[model samples]
Target: MDKNLLGNNVIAQIGILVHDIEKTSQVYAEFFGMMKPEWSLTDAVDKAKTEYKSEPTEARAKLAFFDMGSLQLELIEPDEHPSTWREHLNEHGEGPHHIAFFIKGMEEKVKLLELNGMALTQKGEYTGGRYAYMDTFKELKVMVELLENDN
Candidate 1:
């Protein structure tokens, strides 16, 4: 396809699905000998404007982050509501979820991926940015997340 659809190939983060954030975060922290970061709930539907498979959804998730130099490790605990995270957890049972890249022009990036056969799965807003998950598992073996910070 087009060269550098993502503009840059640097991976900003790696996300993991977990059934229990508290227990999982503790395990990661102890294993890595790092302080466990506090986990927080994602924004509500209204604020997050979450959508699943192109439909609006109330799905939310608890998230914990650990900074690992150039890459951040994220752990996600999805609610019962349907979402990319929840689906992956239910189907795959808690493991790697997505590999994320920080990008500008989210709309264009999403469109490029969509044009290339990677359909958008889920998207939502956060405190300072927004995120979109792309259905890239079949080809890439993992979902792809686009992170756009409003800076």
Candidate 2:
């Protein structure tokens, strides 16, 4: 079997696009006994550090993360600005958006995916690392997120 692209078999997170992160998170917490997630706004994201469709773009969203054992559940509520989250929500409504893999060789994996015809849809940096979202939805039925954390 080909080695896993992420180098690990574990899925880091399952991301969902929601119209209202607070409401959706509440539902998840109530239904699954998951703890309340800590919310973070995308306002701190540097637009100069982000790209969409290979072009500079501005996008923002409210995000919440809940740790579930070795994995995490990520909820995203897109802001009024145009973003991958907004695009997914508009096209498919609020639902499953992507599954993330925490990897080390981010650029190499991204290039590999591109060579395989998966387009890079979005990319940005945060506190500890950077992330890239690949447009693999057509083939995989869900976007693939690659995260490289500086640890």
Candidate 3:
């Protein structure tokens, strides 16, 4: 039980799965008295290099972000592809998906989590960095997202 496996222990974001990004984003924005954030689609499969269960996948999702001070709230509407988001949405319906932590050393962090019995579920590259989704639901009751930025 090495708590140090996850350095800093700060949650950078919370991702929520949704059926409709447009409607959900508007509701959230109105509730907070802010403009609805623009939603964007994830990078194409070739660019993102997304994988699911260790197999290359063409899964992509629409994403919107709300900056909540130190933490970010992400809304995701996944296409009908075999992705973590889509799976969660189909199985559990629209709700919380993952809690993300901004981390360094992507490979090492992923290895550490895998060694600890948290299997890597999905991964992909974004514009400036990459992200990994770990199946930590059995232990943590929620999926864990590891984000490594190339800053």
What TM-score against the true fold does each predicted structure earn? Answer: 0.98, 0.91, 0.98
**What is candidate 3's CA lDDT for residue 107?**
95
Global lDDT of model 1 = 0.96
Candidate with the greatest lDDT versus the true structure: 1
Best first by lDDT, ranked: 1, 3, 2
For model 3, how does the per-residue alpha-carbon lDDT over 1-151 read when each residue is reduced to its tens digit?
6687878689999999999999999999999998899999999899999999999998999999999999999999999989999999999998899999999999999999999999999999999999999999999989999999999
Clashes of 2: 0
Off-target runs (Cα >4 Å) in candidate 3 are: none
For every candidate, C-alpha RMSD to the true structure in Å: 0.7, 1.9, 0.7
lDDT values for all models: 0.96, 0.85, 0.94
- Local accuracy of candidate 1 as per-residue lDDT tens digits, 38-94: 999999999999999989999988999999999999999999999999889999999
Among all windows of 10 consecutive residues in model 3, the one with the lowest summed lDDT is 1-10
Model 2 residue runs over 4 Å out of place are 1-3, 43-48
